[model samples]
Target: MCWCGIAVSQILAVRVDLWNNGNLVQDIFLGEIKVPVKVLRNDSFQAWYLLQPRENGNKSSKTDDLGSLRLNICYTEDCVLPSEYYTSLRNLLLKSSDVQPVSASAAYILSEVCRDKYDAVLPLVRLFLHHHKLVPFVAAVAELDLKDTQEANTIFRGNSLATRCVDEMMKIVGKHYLKVTLKPVIDEICESPKPCEIDPIKLREGDNVEINMENLRYYVDKVFREIVRSSISCPTLMCDVFYSLRHLAAKRFPNDPHVQYSAVSSFVFLRFFAVAVVSPHTFHLRPHHPDAQTSRTLTLISKAIQTLGSWGSLTKSKLSSFKETFMCEFFKTFQEEKFTESVKKFLDDVSSTESKEPSGVSEPVHLKEGEMYKRAQGRTRIGKKNFKKRWFCLTSREFTYHKQQDKEPIFTIPIKNILAVEKLDESSFNKKNMFQVLHGEKPLYIQANNCVEASEWIEALCRVTRCNQKRLSFYHPSAFLNGNWLCCKATTESTEGCARCTADVPADTQIEIDGDRETERIYSLFTINRSKLQKLEEACGSIAVYQGPRKEPDDYSNFTIEDSVATFHTLQQIIDIVEKLNESHEKYQKKRSSSAKYGSEENPIVGKVS
Candidate 1:
């Protein structure tokens, strides 16, 4: 298939390098063959010949197939390389060796083009960086003028590639950029007793004296907060900043937990503050995340934090005063009160008026066959804010709600109808505890006494519905965790969605799903033993052969025939016996089915399978 839709030039010739005993013995002409002209750029073709080595004079039998052959396809002589700068640069980079200077020059020229052209070249630069090919990449970056420099920084500040390359650039260009931006902030934060002098080189190399630990901690926290506030889309930049801070801490006060923690805490708080401010309702703090930017950020942050821990003890000198009070208070916000649990019990008491009802009022119908799992008095919303009391009941077969005990049910929902159950924000609709059950287009909103009750009810509902349906709605793991729509199930009309979703495996595809442990053990043993048997035959010069009725002269060797059956004295007998049994069973099945004259559709078992 020609994926590129461009015509490729003809290949001039193919040269083979022959190697013997790990040494290149000779370069041979394997008969000149011309590659087809105007070939589709991305299409592939196959060519094969009898793989035989040439015999040496008086040493023909000594020639062996153990040597290696290397094939090279020549195209520069007959083929025209793409003329566009981008394509030209790609071609330059494609050369195996001795093209770094050419590639570098091409990159510099591309950078000198219009701003958009330079932007297009940025991805290629990033590719080179990703492969750790920094020499030519840095050479190209050095060609950028002041305007190009500012534009590149602006465009890629949030980009992971730029963030990653920035740290490397610091080593080359020195920390003039950081010094210019950070000096003012540091001066502002480090007030009385005079802030320690700032040295860009020392910071870049991870060595700097710390005259004021407290001042540095406050400075780190404030500066990082500003970085998060700037909303630079690149996590690499943010992470590199943390890395620099870690180095500073390491060089200033070795093995000091407080100093090391300042770096870690700064990174954590930067993320925490970023996520908190962006969408207060959700915990998604990842900026430009679920992509390369987020991945780069996480990698850098994790490495930076781990590096910090290695520099000093994580558990040292008891909890810091700031951690003891403020940290404890911060986490307390995420906890739920114990009152939610007791609210369910209290609601049950109030709704227990069935026992005092008049004798004439017949007891409400009970689901006698259904095993009841949960029963609670909850309130279902009527409109936007109307909270009407209802008794919710969950059984093995269905979910039911009643206006009250000893009364006809308001609604009965088959468990299978429940598509999904999700807990709603407690603050939404000014309700303390609420959840919604989605069944097709209609959503039933219900309020519990507290968050705990709402969560428990949602869990119970999902558990029952899952069992009844056996197949839940398909969703990405990330979507489920982030409380977002499944990429596959998104409301968008376009077919484009998550690319990672698995496609159905074709029947012909060689995919093997492993079986149970015992089956695996047996299979492994069978494979090992079969391999040994093959090696034994090769060593003794007695190859295995098939002796069945359909066997040909070319199929078997050193075989014997018995009274009615042909038998082969080889380890392949094990495989032949199994094949014969399978063939006979299949024939017997076909014969029986034909005699009965039963169509597959009439036979549920047969039709249900294939």
Candidate 2:
């Protein structure tokens, strides 16, 4: 048999002939076969073939099967097809499991057509679910289109099929793709309907916005549960999900105290903090993993901490209570001693930093209530024979000493009762770092690491305790007294050092206060101006915008020009401040006038004003 190929601009035809044993017993001319220029479905053309009897002298009417032909036409390039045809092809592929693998191009076309059609995407996804092993289906669901991920997450976040596919994909493709694609869509669907305002003052408006608190609660709980479920099974995805959820919560409900409270409460309820405290290894770096994965997870954990930390500010005492609670629960469940120690250390460190202070300040200026600062190692006199090394911690409230890093303080000195700190006989102990903390009933002789540290400690302590009553009228001038230096500058050289050299305690220590008053003044002004501007913008419903010179021209003259644009709101802010100041003055004048007219109410016998 002979076959001939004919080509045209748009179509190619393959003409076939049939032969029996090469005798040309029958010449069968097949119908014209058009080579597909583009394909809408998996098949390029319909399958068509025929067998015929020889036209020789025998002339038997019964046809003999010589040959049959089948063809599959598909498109590599983009080709539009009806959704029905793509659906049909997908169904056929799913039904024909034993047949050749599903056509990649057909799946691609189906996804491309159904990318935007939610109605069509779900059914396609379901079809792919049955044939996910096929590259075409996998690509359609995960790689080729995002609509599948969105639809799956939106419509069926908890659906078994979709979640299973996602779990598998996360393992196969890693957490990055899930974060960039799937997690956002899920978060969008689960986002709180109430529009969150960045400023707390603006959040007052959201109270009237009508939100379903139950829905918000359910959303947070659901996301938290999913992350917890994946803690062991899908650690990488769990890390990403946790970070994403915390970020969304913090960013969206930054100013909403109730929402922030709810988030913290939810984390506690769901045992999220418990998991974190116990299995930080899962969230943070794994030394055995590659650098990239380690870095990614480490960054994610850090961000998660930051986001959670922003949810609410906890005081040092409250944080200690939380640490105690977490440790209690953590030990109850895991009971790993090593992890317990590490977690306690971590908690101590984090809890110690409960308050965030401004950088570059040498002293803890903004000390929170019960916040410990300036903790260091020092030697305390135990008896005349020995000095014990101890860790000293200073707080606005008290001074404490601890035997170990993670232990509770064994000694405490209240700041309110401490009267004064005096420089001791630095030369007597073969050291220049001795100081005495004079408080109730006795003076405690403490040896610091160096002279500078001793000076700083004494200055800090004196500044905090200068208002207290003097505890001791005079130094005792003795060698030993209740594990303290009773000797006032008494040394071996001098039999009575107190008599030989009188202690000249300064009226004020060398420590300076009211530091950088100019900077503070400028900051206060800026703060006041900012508040006034915000008020003006709120009243006027317009924010001032500054338009600078165009950067494209790069004109040298623009740099020298003094120009700025301000709105009516700018003038309005100044007017508002002036009005407030004037109102204060008027009120002050009215108060004086009333007081003068009323004479002296406190003293009823006083004469009336003339």
lDDT (0 to 1) per candidate: 0.34, 0.36
Q: What TM-score, computed on C-alpha atoms, does each candidate reach?
A: 0.19, 0.20
lDDT score, candidate 1, position 461: 61
Instruction: Quantify how close model 1 is to the true structure by its C-alpha RMSD in Å.
Output: 28.6
lDDT of 2 by residue, 1-610 (tens): 4544333332433323332234332223333333333332323245554443332356555443444544443323121222432343334334322322221232222222221333233443334332333233432232222233332212223323223333333333233322332243233432323232122333354353124223333333333333322221222222222333333344454554334233223332223333332233232311111122222222323223322332232333424454334222222322234322333232222222122121223454422222222212233333334456666777656777777555798878877667556666644454456776656544566777776677667655643443343433344433343344445533432232252212222222121222223122222232344544343333223222333333343322211111112223233433444344445545755765567554354212222111
List the candidate 1 regions with Cα displacement exceeding 4 Å. Answer: 1-387, 424-433, 475-610
lDDT of 1 by residue, 531-552 (tens): 4434333322332233324434
Cα RMSDs of all predictions? 28.6, 34.9
In model 1, the clashing pairs are 158-233, 158-234
